[model samples]
Target chain A: MTIRSVAIIGLGLLGGSIGLAIREKLSEVTTTGFDADADVRGRATANGLVGAVCDTAAQAVASADLVILCVPVGAMGDAARGLAGCLKEGAIVSDVGSSKRSVVSALEEALPDAIVIPAHPVAGTERSGPDAGFATLFEGRWCILTPPKNADTDAVSALTLFWQELGATVELMDPDHHDLVLAVTSHIPHLIAYTIVGTASDLEDVTRGEVIKYSAGGFRDFTRIAASDPVMWRDVFLNNRDAVLEMLGRFTEDLTAMQRAIRDGDGDRLLEIFSRTRAIRQAILEQGQDVAKPDFGRGSKEV
Target chain B: MTIRSVAIIGLGLLGGSIGLAIREKLSEVTTTGFDADADVRGRATANGLVGAVCDTAAQAVASADLVILCVPVGAMGDAARGLAGCLKEGAIVSDVGSSKRSVVSALEEALPDAIVIPAHPVAGTERSGPDAGFATLFEGRWCILTPPKNADTDAVSALTLFWQELGATVELMDPDHHDLVLAVTSHIPHLIAYTIVGTASDLEDVTRGEVIKYSAGGFRDFTRIAASDPVMWRDVFLNNRDAVLEMLGRFTEDLTAMQRAIRDGDGDRLLEIFSRTRAIRQAILEQGQDVAKPDFGRGSKEV
Candidate 1:
C-alpha cells in the first residue's frame, strides 16, 4: 500500500528534514509532526516542515499510514510505547536511529502488532534542532532499512519506495549487520573525533586559544564531527555499545601499531599505510559519496 | 635588505603556491624554483609557478637573496646541503616543514654560514604536487617562524614580511613549542585519520564497498585528511615522533575513558565531553580558522 499520510514523532534535524523533504517533494503526502519541546514544534510548524503539528504522538499517528520515530536511540522504546492503541492495523512503523539492533528490538517489543522496519538515513549536518534542517538534506544520501526476517515483502517495498521518493538510495540488511556496518563507518569515526578534540582542548602546553587559532592546520575538521548533537551521539554510543566497543578495539590496535612504527622510525611502514588510505579516499570520491574538491570545498566558499 | 629575488626549492604544493603568490602579489620580486622531479619542474615552469624553473638546486639558490626549502621534514637536511656553496653570502635561508625542531637543526647544521630560519605555513589541502597549488593557498592562514636565539632580528623581520605579503599571519615560536603545538593540531590528527581509515578498510564484517558508500555518516571527513601527501606525512611522523607520541598517549587515555563511559552507559560523561567540544568548534569559527557553515560547506557545493 502507498504511504499517503505520515507521522514524525520528533522534529529535530532528521525528523524535521524528513518532514520538509516530504512536503517539498511529495506534495500529495499529508505530513503530521510532533516534538517534545514546544518551541521545536512551533518552529517546525511555522517553517512548513509538516502540514500539521500534532500535540500528542497518539494524535499524530492516529490517521497516518506511516509513523517514523525520530527521537534518540535511547528513547525509542518509550516513544514506541507512547503510540499504543493509536497506530492503525497494517500501518508500517519505522525510525531514523543511528543504531539498529537495539532500536529494532525496542520498537518490535513495544509495538508487536505493527510492521516495524528500522532504517537509518546516513546523512546529516553538524547542526541540530528544528531550524537546522533543510529540504534537500536527503538528496544523494543512502538509507539502509533493517527489516525483520518475517516482515511482509510489500511493506518493505513500500517503505523503500517512500525513501526513494524523498531522494535516497535504499539498501536492505539484517539489524545486526546494520549496527556493525554503521559502527565502523559512523560510530568509531565520531568517537575518535570527539576523543581527539577533547584531548587537544585539555592540553596544558598548547593553550586552547592556540588550538583554535591554528585549527585549519587539521584540528578544525575533527571539531566539526565532535560538534554533532551531544545527546543523540551519547544515546548512540550507549545503545550500540557492543558494536562500538568492538570496532574501537580494532581501531586502538591499528593505532598502536602505527604508533610503534612512528616510534621505531619506520618511514616505509608509515608511507605504506598512508598510501593505502589515499586510495580509499579516491574510491569514496569515485563512488560519488564525497566531493573531489580539496579541503572538503571549504576554501572555495565565502564565510 | 628589502628582498627582491626569491628562490624556492622542492616546487611542490607549498613551494609552488609561494611562487604563484609572489608573482601575483609581489610583482617586482624575481622568482626562481627547482624540484627534484623533472616533470614537476617542467610543470612549474609551464604553470608560471615561478618566473624561472632552474635545472638544478644549485642554480636555483645561486642568485637569490631569499631561499626557502619546501621539502618533507626528513628531507630538509639533504635539500639544505644541496645548496651549501650556491647560496650567496648573507642570503636568508628558511624552510616550510611541518615539524620545526628537526628542520631547524637540519638547516642550521647544513648551511651553518647562511641565515637559517625555519618556518611552517599551517595551511594545505589533501592533494599535493605542483598542480595542487593556488596563489591564495596561504591567505589568512598562520605561518609560524622558529628562528634560533642568535639569529639576526632584521632577517627574522624580513622573513615575516615576506610571508605577510603572501597573505599569511606570522607568529614567532620556539622550535620545540612549534613542534608541540603542531603535534596536537596537525600531526596527531593526520595520524588518527590514517589509522581509522585503515581500520575501516581492514574490517572483516563490513565490505569495502559498504564502507565507501556509507562514508558520509562521518568517515568521509577522515578520508580527506588521510588522503594528504603520504611522503610528507611519513616524514612528519618520523621527525615529530616525540610530540606526536606524547599527544597520542593523551588521546589514548581520553579515548579509553570515553570507551569506559560507553560500556558503563555513562550518558552524562559522554554528553559533557560532546558539549565541551562543540564550544571549541565555535571558538575555531570565531577565530576565522574554519567556516561556520555545516559539513564544511560540502552540502551546498556540487561535486
Candidate 2:
C-alpha cells in the first residue's frame, strides 16, 4: 500500500520535529498531528508542521498508515490506550521515547493485535516543546527500532522506511538491549547533569554566579545538559530506575576509586584512564558521531 | 610608565590564547613567549602570536615589563622561581592559573620583591597547547585578579588595564576566596565529567560507541568536558585537593539524596531541585555568560 498519510500523536519537540522532517522529505504524504495541549496543536499548525491538527489522539491516527507516540515514557500506556482502537488496522504504532522496553511492553499490552514498534530516534537537546523542534534534528542520526519478533512485517517495513526518508540511519534491536544501552549512554548521564546543576543551585549566590560565568572551563557543559527538560528526565530516571542506579553504582565506585588514586598521587592510574578515554572520543570522531571542535566551538557562535 | 613588551610563560592553551588575545587586542605591545617544548615556541612565532619566541623562560621575561604565567598550577612555583631574578624589578607579574591563593603563596616565596599578582581569566576549553590559542578567548569574560595588600599601584593598574583592553571585565577577590570558589565551580565538575566519561568508556565497545553517537542528548556535553587536557586537570585536582574533596563530599551527599528522591518517585524533590537550577542558568544569561543559542548550535565542529 502506498503511504500517503501519517499521524503524529504528540506535537512537542520530537513529534513536531518528525512532522517537519517528514513534510520536508515525503513530498506526497500528509502529516496529521495531535498533542494533549491545545496550544501546542495550534503552534504546530501555525508553523506549517502538519497538514491538519486534530482534537483527539484517535482522530489524529485515523485514516493514517503509521502513528508515532512522542509523549513522556510515563504517559505511554495512557497515550497508547487512547489511540489503540482508532488506529488504522495496518498502521504501525511506534514511539520516540527514551526508555524502550517499558514503553514497548506497556503500549503493546494496552491493545491486542496492534502492530507496536518501539523506535527511538537518538537525537534531541535539553530544550522541548514545539518551538524547540527542528526539521534537521534527526539528519545523519541513528533511529533504533525495537520491533517484537511477532510484530507485523508490513508495519515494521513502513516505519523503517518512514524514518529512513527522514534522513536517519535505522537500526533494529531488541527492546531490552535498547534500555540497557540507553541507560548507560543517555539516561544516566542526564540524571547526573541534572543532579549536579541542581547541586550547584544550592550553593551561595556569589559562588553560584562564578560557576556559570566560568562554565566554559568545564561546568558550563554540564549546565547545558542539566538544562534539559526536567519532566522528561524525571520520567526517564523513574522509568529506567534499575539500569540508571546500576550505572550510577558503577560510576560512583569508579569515581571513588579514582578520587582515592588522585589523593594518593597515583598519576599513573589517572593518566591511563585519561588516555584510554581519548580513544573512545577518537572512535566517536571516526564514526562521525562527535565533533572535535574547540569547546564544541561554542566560543564562535558568531563564527 | 609605558608598557612596551609582555612575556608569556608556558605556551599552552591558556598562555597561547592570552598571547593571541593580547596581540590581537593591543596594537602597541611586543610579546615574547616561551614554552617547555621548543616546537611550541616555533608554532607560536609562526602563528604570529608572539613577536619573538624566546630561547628560554628567563630570556622571555628578561626585558619584559609584564610577565603572565599560564602554566599548570603545579608548575607555577617553579616557573616563578625560574623567572624571579630575570623579571624586570618594577614589572607587573600576573598569572592565569586556576587557583589564586596557592599560586600567590608559592610565588610569594619565589618573587619576594616583584609585584606578583595572581589572576585567573575564567576561560578555557578541553583542547590545549599553542595550537589551541584564540584571539578572543577572553572577550566578554571575567579576569579575576587577587593582589597582595601592598601591591604596587602602577603594577596592578597596568595589568588590569591590559586585560580590560582584551575585553574582559576585571574583578578583584581575596586569593583564598578565589580558590574556594573555583573548587566548587570548576574543579569538582571537571572531576565528575572525567569520571562519568571514564565509566562509559569502560562499557562494552558496542554500547560505548552508541553512547558517543547519541551523546548530543547530554553525554556529549560531558565528553566535551572530559576531552579537556588531562595533564592540566590532573594537576588542578592534585594542587586543589582539599577544596575539591570538600566539594566532592557535598556533591556525593546531594547525589545520594537525589537518588533516593528519584527512587521514591518524589517528583516534588526532583522538580524542586531542577526548578531551582533554571534560576542559575537565568542568572548566567543575565550576566551574559552563556549563549542562549542551541547548545553549540548547528554547523558546529563536533568532530
Candidate 3:
C-alpha cells in the first residue's frame, strides 16, 4: 500500500514543512491538515502548507491513507486520540515528535487497530508556527523511524520512502534507542541553552541590557536554541524525562568538573577536555550535519 | 603623539586581524607584529597580516607608539614580560584578553613605566591561529576599554578612537565589571558549551557517530562553540575563575530548577522560562549583535 493521501494534525513548523515538502516533491499525493490554533490554520491555508486545511482532524483524515501527528511530545496521545474515532482503517499513523518511545506508546494506545510507526525527522529551525517552515527544512537531514515489532513492514517502507522523497535520509531504529539518542543530540542541548540564557538574564551584576548588547561574544548562539518553541520543548522534556534526566546528570557532572578545573587553575585538564571536544565538532561538520563556516558563517563574510 | 605607528605582540586571530584591519582602514599607519611561533610570523608576513612581521617582540615595538598584546589570558603576563626589556618608553600598552582584571594586573606589574590599558574586543569565531584573522572580524563588534583609574585621559581617548577606526563601537568599563559582564556573556556560555559537548560524546549508551549525525537538532550549535581554540578558552576560564564560578553557580541552580520542572512535569514553569528567554534573542537581534537569519544563517546558502 502506498501513501497517496496524507493528513497532518497540528500545522506548526514540522507539520507545515512536511505538507509543503509533499506539495513540492510529491505533488501527486493529496495533503490535508488541521491545527488546534485557528490563527495557525488560517496561516497554513494562506501559505498553502497543504492542499486542504480542514476544520477538524477527523475531516482531515477522512480520505487519507497516512496520518501524521505533529503536535508536542506531551500532546501526542491527545492528538492521536482525537483521530481515533474517525481515522480510516489500515491508515498508517506516525509522528514527528522528538521522543519516539512515548509517542509510539501513545499512538498504539490511541489507535489500536492502525499501523502506527513513530518517526522523528531530525531537522528544524528555531522558528515555529505554520509560517516558519520551508520546503528545504528537511533537505540533507535525517529522519529516524521506529516501528513496532508486529507492525506491517510495507507500511514502514512506504513511510520511509515518503520521507526520502522529501529529501531526508531515512534510518530505522528501536523507539527506546531513538529517545536516548535524541536526548543526547537534541533534548539536553535545548535544556542547557534554556538554562544559560535564563542565568544570563537573571544576573544582578550584569544588567539585562548589557547581556543583550554583548551577546555576540558567545551568548547569542545559545539564544537561538533557547528561542525555540517553548511549549514544544516543554513537552519534549516532560515526555522524555528519563533520558533527559540521565543526560542532564552527566552534563552537570562534567560541568562541575570543568568548574573545579577553572577554580584550581588546572589549565592542562581544561585544555585536554576542550581539545577532545573539538574533534567531535569536526566530525559533525565532516558528516554534513552543520555548516563548517567560521562563526557558523553568520558574520564577517570574507571581505 | 598622534598614534602613527602600532605594534602587535601576538600574531593569533585577534592580533593578525588588528594588523589586517589597520592595513585596510588606516593604510598610512605602519603596523608591525611578532608571534612566539616562527610559523605564525611567516604566515603573518606572507598573508600581509601586518606591514612588517618582526623576528622578536623588541623589533616589533622598537618604533611603534602603541602596542597591543593579543595572547591567551593566562599568557598575558609572560607575553608582557617578553616585551619588558625592549618596550619603548612612553608607548601606550593595551591587550585584547577576554578577562580584564587579571590582564590589567599582569600588565601593570610587568610594564610599570609604560601606560597600560586593557581592552577586550568582545568578538571571535571558533577558528583560531594567524590564518584565522580577517579585517572585518571587529566590524560592528564591541571593544571595551578598561583603563586604570589614574591613566592618562589622552591615551584612553587615543585608544578608543583607534578601536573606533577599526570599526568596533568603543565603550569604557571597569575591569571588574567587564569581567563580570563577560563572565555572563562569554565565559560561562563557553564553559557550558564545552561541558555539554563533552557530556554528549562521553555517553556510554549512545554511540558518538549517532551524536555527530543528528547534531543538527541543536547539539551542533554547541559543538561550534566547543570547537573554539582550546588553549585560549582554558586561559579565559582560568583567568576569570571567580566570575565564571559565580555565573556557573547561578546557571547550575537554574538548570536544577529546569530539571525539576521536567521531572515533575511542570509545564507552566518550563513554558514561562522558555518564553522569557525568547524575548532576549529578539532583543539581541534588534540590537544587531547577532544575525537574525535562521540556523545562524548557515547551510542552504553555502551548500
Candidate 4:
C-alpha cells in the first residue's frame, strides 16, 4: 500500500514544498510536478523541486500512485478533471486545500474512478510560489486528512504514513468539522488580517507612510498575514462561505462587545478578556504549535 | 540643555529597556529607576537595569534632568504626582504610554512646574517586566514626541537627542494626532487581536486543544499580540477611546463588505482587497520598520 511515485499538480509553494519534502524524507518515492504556469515549471525544474518537472498535469500523474492536486481550491475540479484518464489504476487522489468540504466534493465529482482523500497541512508562511517553499515546511506541523466514509482503509493508512514521513503529524476528521475548525483557526484570521491592513491604508488622517513607519506597534504582524497569496485566500472564502461567515459572525459580535467596553470605559471587562487570551498563547507554545520567544523570536539573531 | 541624570518611574518592559539602552549607548548619563511593585524593584536591582534602583519615586527623580514615567497610561498622573517636588527646576518630564493626549494632560496636571514632553517609543515585545528588557529593544524603532505648545525648545531638543542616543529615530507629533494615528497602528490592532483570540478559544464547537494545534495557520500571530500586558492594553483602550472606536468602525465596515462578497460568491471582490494589502507589507519592509524575510524570518536559523 506504500506510495511509490507522487505527482504534484501545482508547482507553487505547497506543491513545490511537497516535492522537496518527499525528496528529502522519502528518496525512495519518486516525484514529478507540473504547473499551469510555464514560468513556474521552468523554475521548479531549475530548483530540482521534484525528480521530474512534467509539461502537463496529465503527464505528471501518468505513473504516480499518489496524485496530489495543489492548485487553489477553486481550481480543484479542473485540476482533477485534467487527470481523469491519466491516473494509474488504484491511484489515491488528494489535495492540500485550506477548506475541506468543498474540496472533498469537488475531487469526488471530477475523479469518481480515483480514490479521493483530502488533506490540509496547517502550516505556511506569508510567501507563495515555488521559490518561497522549503523541504522542512511541514516539520512538526499538523496535517488533517478528510477521507470519505466509504474510502478504503488501506489507502487511508498508506496516505497517513506518507505524510508522517514528511515530518507532519496526521489526524483524521469529518470534512464538515475540518472546515469549521479551519474557519476559526485559519480562514477568519486571514480575513480579519486582510480587512485590517486595508482599513489602516484607507484612513485619511493617518497617511500610508505613517502606518508603514510605525508598524512595530502591532500593525506589522497583520501585514505579514495579509501578504499571503490572494488567489488562494479568495478561493478559500468562496469555497468555505458558510463556515467562514458563521465564524465571522461570532468574531464580529465579540469585537462589538469589546468596542462597547472601550466606549463605556469598562477597564475591568477589557482586563478580563485580555488576561484570558494570554493563556491560549501559553497553550499554543506548550503544544509546540508556535515559537515561545518574544516577537516570534524575531528580535534575536538566531531564531 | 544636556541631560546629565535621567530617572525612570516604572521598571517594567519600557522602563527597564530604557535603563539598559542608556547604560549601553549613553555610558556618561546616570540613571535611577523605581517601580511601585516591590518584587519588580528587587528584580531591577539584581538585573542592574539602572545605575541605581531607588526605593521611592521622589528619591529617583531628585537631581535628575529628565524623568520618564513608564507605568500604565492609567497610572501616569499618579507616577508624575509622586515626582512633583523632587525634579530639578528645568528638568523635563515625559512618559512612554501608548495614548498621547491623555498622558500629556495627566503629566502636565500632575507636575505643573516641570517641562512636560510626552513621548511614546513605538516598540515592545509581548513579554513584560524588568527581566524582559533588552538593550536593543528600541534599535531601529520610532520614538514619537508630543510636546505642549509652550514647552521650551531646548528641553524638547534635549529629549529628542536623548531618544536618538538610545538607537531610536525621533519624530514630533501633535498629542491628539498621535492618539488618532496610534489608534490605527497599535490600539485597534491590539483590540482586534484580543477579540479574535478570545472568540477562537470560546467556541463551543471547536476544542481549545484543536485551536492551539492548528494555530500556525494564522491564529498564532494574533495570540502573540493578544498576549501583551493586559493592564497596559486596558488603559490604552480607555484612554484612546474615540480614535479606537473610529478606526474600529471603519474596520467593521470593511469586514462587512468582505462578508457580503463571500456570501454572494463574489471572488473578484475578495481578491481585490487581498491583493492590495500585500503592497503595504512591502512598503513596511522598505521603510525598515520590519524584517524583509518571510515569516519575520522565523524559519531561518539566523534571524
DockQ of all models, two decimals each = 0.72, 0.55, 0.77, 0.73
For residues A1-303, what per-residue lDDT tens digits would candidate 2 score against the true structure? Answer: 457888988888898888888878887899898899989988888887788999998888899887888999989899989986797877778899998878988987997778778999888876789887777778777899999888778777878888889878898988777787888778878777777777776776346667777665566666767777777877787788877777888899988997797788887787676666666666666776566666554554324
Clash counts for the predictions, in order: 0, 5, 0, 0
Candidate 4 per-residue lDDT over residues B177-227, each given as its tens digit: 999999998888899999999999899999999999999899998998999
Runs of candidate 2 exceeding 4 Å displacement: A301-303, B204-206, B299-303
Per-residue lDDT for A239-293 in model 3, tens only? 8899889888888888889888888989899999999998898898788888766
- Per residue, candidate 1 scores C-alpha lDDT tens digits across A47-121 of 888899999989899989999999999999999999988998889999999999999889989988889988999
Ranking by DockQ: 3, 4, 1, 2
Pairs that collide, model 2: A290-B302, A291-B302, A291-B303, A292-B302, A292-B303
Residue-level error in angstroms, candidate 4, position A77: 0.3
Candidate 3: residue pairs that collide = none
Which regions of candidate 3 fall more than 4 Å away from where they truly are? B301-303
Q: Which residue segments of model 4 deviate by more than 4 Å?
A: A297-303, B297-303
Model 1 lDDT, residue A190, Cα: 94
Best by DockQ: 3
Restricted to chain B, the TM-score per model reads 0.98, 0.95, 0.97, 0.98
CAPRI tier of model 4: medium
Decreasing lDDT order of the candidates: 4, 1, 3, 2
**Candidate 4: residue A134 lDDT (0-100):** 81
Q: Which residue segments of model 1 deviate by more than 4 Å?
A: A300-303, B299-303
TM-score, cand. 3 vs. native: 0.98
